[model samples]
Target chain A: MTPSSFVKLDGVAKRWNGQLGVEGISLDIPEGSFTALLGPSGCGKSTTLRLLAGLELPDEGTISIDGKDVTTSAASDRNLSMVFQSYALFPHLSVAENVVFGLKVRRVSKKERQVKLHRALEITGLLGYERRKPGELSGGQRQRVALARAIVAGQRLCLMDEPLSNLDAKLRNAVRKDIKKLQRDLGITVVYVTHDQTEAMSMADTVVLMKDGHIQQIGSPDDLYSRPNNTFVAEFVGAPPMALIDATAFASVFDNSATVGIRAENIQIVPSGQGRLRCVVTESEFLGAETLIGLDHAGASGLCVLKPGLAMVAEGSEIDIDFQDESLHVFDADGQRLTG
Target chain B: MSAHANLERRRQAIYGWLLLSPAAVLLTLFAFYPSIATLWSSLFSRGTRRRPSEFVGGENYTDLFADPTFWLVVKNNLLYAGVTIPVSIFIALSMALWANSKISARGFVRTAYFTPTVLPMIAAANLWLFFYTPGLGVLDQIGSVFGLPSVNWLGQPETALWAIIIVTIWKEAGFFMIFYLAALQTIPEDLKEAADIEGASRWTYTRRIVLPLLMPTTLFIAVNAIINSVKLIDHLFILTKGGPSDASKLILYYIWEMAFAFFDAPSAAAMTIMVIAVLGVVAAVQFFYLDRRTHYQ
Candidate 1:
């Protein structure tokens, strides 16, 4: 364990109704770093966040926050704050009252509560909405109110469970940037939970990819994208995931019992009979900046090539495509990456 | 084109009213017409064997106002309402919290709580009658084991109304609990977790978050309880018969006795009109005052 680790979990496990929620999970989150628990639904990303927030107690393990074992402690004693996906703002209270609820519960002085409330509202861009009820606010405004409430509580560790999932696309982007900026400015450690890879990759200092109650990989977004630990991480980290093909199909490139992985962007098209492999275009999607051509190679589906700048490739056209050797990822038969 | 659009709108309005006519006609016949008829009759004198009915404007109301029994029953009804509404609502909320919690045999507990609601008020009154009966009653039998003297629960003026109030509360609380339980279920679980993470104590969370969120449900249940208090006079017919000097007689019970037992329709009609006016005021207060404060999605 690193001496600088601010939060540590050792072999944390949780079971719900005799089924594993998560098991054998260990992590060391550094101080003031923004880490994201990124995975698909039901992959225990939210469960991990809940555990850190002390909402759910681990069935097996010790959870230490700043060198204090809080595995058996109540959530209220954890000295953390959470922003929910539903916002969870008190509907009856005005925006100012909602933001100051934690301070009031702790019996903080009225003056200090007001000062913190004002600062939180200012940070979240909700200063003018002090008198509006949560029901009176828009989705984005409500989300900001929830953020302001968490910030005003002044907890050093803030947990957010898919907080931006409720907003529309444009508003989500704006709020995402705002949350990132707020975290950096406050120097508070944040553990964000998200199923959206784009959200995790764009905002997090470290992305902890999980699947099926296990951690797949934990690293910077570029590390996972450039050198995935396994086939799952390779496919999960990118925009359009990397394609896995049989090693025999690329026998001339390498003679090994492995799965050949190549991203869509690394496959280049050339004149027929000139490149290493020949294929026929089955479908073409024109996405303005790039055209994705779906190719049929040796009965393998989803062998796609992303061509830059509106390349027009008609259906059933014969084409030669070659993999970028330097960019190719080789995974062994067990699906583990063969090299760093 | 404008004429065509106008014709289309007229046709749509006719269709709308056509669909609503059945319920509208039923409400007029059963609800509106009776209220109007009762008000119209309240201004007149009751017909007797030797004399025809006469149009004595405000005479029935004047007589009603002068009657001490009328005032006493109104006080009793108010006391009954004052006791039953808040106590029953509090018990219902507690019961809902229990039923919604992760307790053993939860389904059985919910069913047991709701069973009293499903039982007819008359049958429930009969069941309670055995419990309130002196000496040989279940309550007295239990008291005897504790070496306590037999107490006449429904005989005295002070205890008679209270006994009836207890029975009404027992019956009505379970029905209101179903509403509270449904509302509690609709509250997101994440809110509780969020409260926990915010370092709010359980009591604080319930007061600041849970209870405020439940205000709409409380209002809804309160309105139902008010209506039930007026309509639920069936137990009185079997339990106390408003007995020992009309001690437990509510407005509805007195109105029934005046109309059927005394055959004084004008007096009964006047009391009925008064009841309707009180209910109208309550509805207005609920709609204009409370509704504005409630948050609904």
Candidate 2:
């Protein structure tokens, strides 16, 4: 592997009692980059992270970190740290003690441990709370403690499993920025596992979208959103996900039997008899700055168009929606993206 | 105050008392009344057929202090508590750790470890009685196979107390293990995974994380174990019965012997009062002192 590939997994597969965990899982993460394993629950995102952390062994293939084979090694031997979703702070230990526990175990000098602990806590904005136990801290403060603990060891690689999931929405947004900034400033390679697409897209430099224990696509957030590999990725990557139209509905446009995919923003409300397709306004949702007008068509599902503020249309009103031919995405019968 | 407010306040007072009455009545009937009655009777001489009973303040207690058998039982009990409390707790913790790990037949292992706890103390004592019964006993039977002498476990003075201690530990450890197991399950699995990623070894994880987290349970089990050291002497009745020289006697067994076997009710009442006082003090210390140091999740 090249030096850019700081961590690599090749043909990693894990099965429990003949049940699939993850199969043919291969990935390469560059140094000092943020890669997110994004998927819904039971899609093996966490399982892949666990396998890379050395918390679980793979049934096949190899994992190497910093050019060293570490597939069979213990989690500790692999030289990494992780933040759990529960924030897994040692409940009895004070913030400082929890952060420095691994250092003490590693026989680091007390002075060095104190230095590292102070730096980590300061970075995580938890400086004054070092003396407080986890039980005494707020949920957000406890989560910061978990972050401090993960960073205190100064490992080159850090893994985070839905670390912000337990926090409230406002706090999640703030911590999300803080984590991305932490990864950037520290120059650490971070592998984050999250079910929230917004978290993956907003924070990660590379998003590896997965489904049903297999990778759907591995690309930059823009790539996944703009050029999805399959129907699952096309629908999963964007908000108000991409809508699909059966080929028969648009048989006059394309001769091959394929599905048409289009983004919500590309579809517009056109005057009667002038639009490509006629649709009815089913419902309209008033967002703070915009309104999402839901459209119903016999040939389409999840067809909606974004309109400017306060665009309330009465339900059951017929509206014609039109889109450019070039903007449509074509997929084969198996849902694989078809190149023109 | 307004008449309506006053009426509401009176109703709340009555409601509060109604909530407390069940516990108040139970404690008075079972604990408080019995303790006061024991103290009252302890100050009097035991009544005889020819003589009426008369109050002899603190005389029964003085007689107990003068008795050699009382001191012997106290010493035996101290030794028993000192040895069995730590031994049983350690065994229970070890067994709990082993059984909690990811192993094949985990359900069977847990059930096997918990079987002795499910059996009643008297029934378990009888089951061990067969093991301690001199020649045909399991201990001697195993010893004979190793070409060792078939020594009497419960008949002799030195071995008799130890024999009782062994049965107590065996019976008590399994019961304590169940508590440890329950406490272990409350600990999140991700904590261990977090520890492992931090490079903590199995021993370090146990000592630093597992042991500290289990402090509350340990404190609770310790109080239970101390109370049990005084309370559970049923095995002594079956296995050693205060023995050839009162070598295997515990304080409770001596109290039972004083009241029922020898029919000296005053002495038994005095001893009973002392036992309650010691246990009450221990419970107080556990709540006021040790509870502060223990961590609850």
Candidate 3:
């Protein structure tokens, strides 16, 4: 009911056979914003995207697009376009034909279809490659073709399901930036599904973190990383993910918290006698711009700190590390954030 | 190139030829030799009790061209092919779609549709004969229930060839369905999901996406169907025996009658050569024209 809400799902749930695929899901996507449903595999992120695309029907609750209930509408009737994980370009069709497939299906006039196809292909940087079939294109080119196909439909909302997963690491990074820029330029609502946190963090205006068919947190990337609502979100949102420490291990530092979380970058290594927690350096890895120091203390393993430049501490050397007080995240017994 | 590398290359060539020798030998003996021998023999006259075999030099071919029975059988075979190929393919596609769907008793339905494929051609022909037998046949019995006259399904020239065409389609469609089913399964489920989201109707998806994707399979099945139309004469033997005044006499059955029943070897050889030439033209058209339109990937 919010003024900004364009696409809304109210208590939506879907089941495959007798088992639940996604349940009790509610979300409001603001118009023209890039949103990401992010989770590990089997986390119901894809099922949610398919439900929104109208490829799968929800068993409960209602889905409304622009104030119109479309819970029972056919996928074609919903007027939404999607790019699949496999690209799913018609192998028999040329890239140009693939892009204009939706227009042809809708009986759009030839002149309009050609205009849209040209614009889409030009935007996706696939202008001259339009004559080539999908089988002839490389992975990144095929992905762009899928993107061109989705955008050519001129639908207000577009869904993408791991569209860059098929590309190489270098191509993935390039295409990720292309997609982010394209979304901004086109001003279309995008619901992207990704298991990779980096993709979600880099591309989304609002990242919806999911686990086991339920949303753990929904916020901006910075909000998710700095102020995670639960242990799951805290552990999921960042690279060298935030580590959860037993509260009892640091009794003096934590009084009532069940779990304490700290980012690797926030742990400062100082002289052994000046710090609160002391541990022996176990391993050190030299990454190009930063070095990561791994530490183990008393039976609990897992303290990794990122130090700028080459800082190598010899193995078995005792070191003292102090947690930055502002960066410490405390959680209650129920795994929810314990706010002051 | 160095001498050692050159020797190794020669060795590899010999090894490759050695590996291919068995297939080459079988093809030469069974296919190439028979084809050339048929053509060569068609140029000679059949030996008789008083006259020894003599060089005919196109006489047999000229007689074959002038023969009414030969032309009639050729016409019948062409009709059989024109009717069977497309109809069987369409039915096979439908059967594949049904078998691939999430219908109840899906396993049983697939097995039932595929059952005729494993049945012997003669056995299938005999079974259909029982169904087409005038008054006692299943079809006539069903018709009689509606008080419709007991029609002669295979006993009259008007309906005999059509009855043969129907039975051939039934026998071969299930076999063709297996190929179509395999092709259908290979299509990524994501394509269908993508089509759905792209706002394509089911008919549009099948026509534009599914059918185009299936072209390679259709081409493959068409080649098989064409060959079967010429070679599968077991049904003709059991059902009509090219009877009702040769109304359903295909080229292969006519060749058999000419060669064995009437002992006209030279004429039969000429007819066989003609059939081979027709098949060659079909293969050429498939490889050159249809293959260009088929998307292999």
DockQ of each: 0.72, 0.84, 0.81
Candidate 2 segments exceeding 4 Å error: A255-257, B1-10
Error of 2 at A151 (Å): 0.9
Residue-by-residue lDDT tens digits, candidate 2, A244-320:
88877754476574788999999988899888888889999999688999989898888999998999999999998
True contacts kept of 1: 0.80
Tell me each candidate's i-RMS in Å: 1.4, 0.9, 1.0
Residue B210 CA error for candidate 1 (Å)? 1.9
* Candidate closer to the true structure by DockQ (higher is better), 2 or 3: 2
What residue runs in model 1 are displaced by over 4 Å at the alpha carbon?
A: A1-3, A252-255, A299-301, B1-5
Clashing pairs in 2: none
Best candidate, lDDT: 2
- Give the TM-score of chain B in candidate 3: 0.97
Report lDDT (CA) for all predictions.
0.89, 0.91, 0.90
lDDT by residue for model 3 over B4-119, one digit each (tens)? 99999999999999999999999999999999999999999999999988998999999988899888898999999999999999999999988998899988988898899899
Model 3 RMSD, rounded to 1 decimal: 1.7
Q: Model 1: per-residue lDDT, tens digit, A1-340? A: 4646888989999999999799888999998999999998999999998888888889999899988899989888888888998988877789999899888888999999989998999898888999998888999999999999888877888999999999999999999999999999999999999999999999999999999899999999998889899988888878778877777774446656478788898888887777866788899988899988888888343578998888878999889888767778888878898876
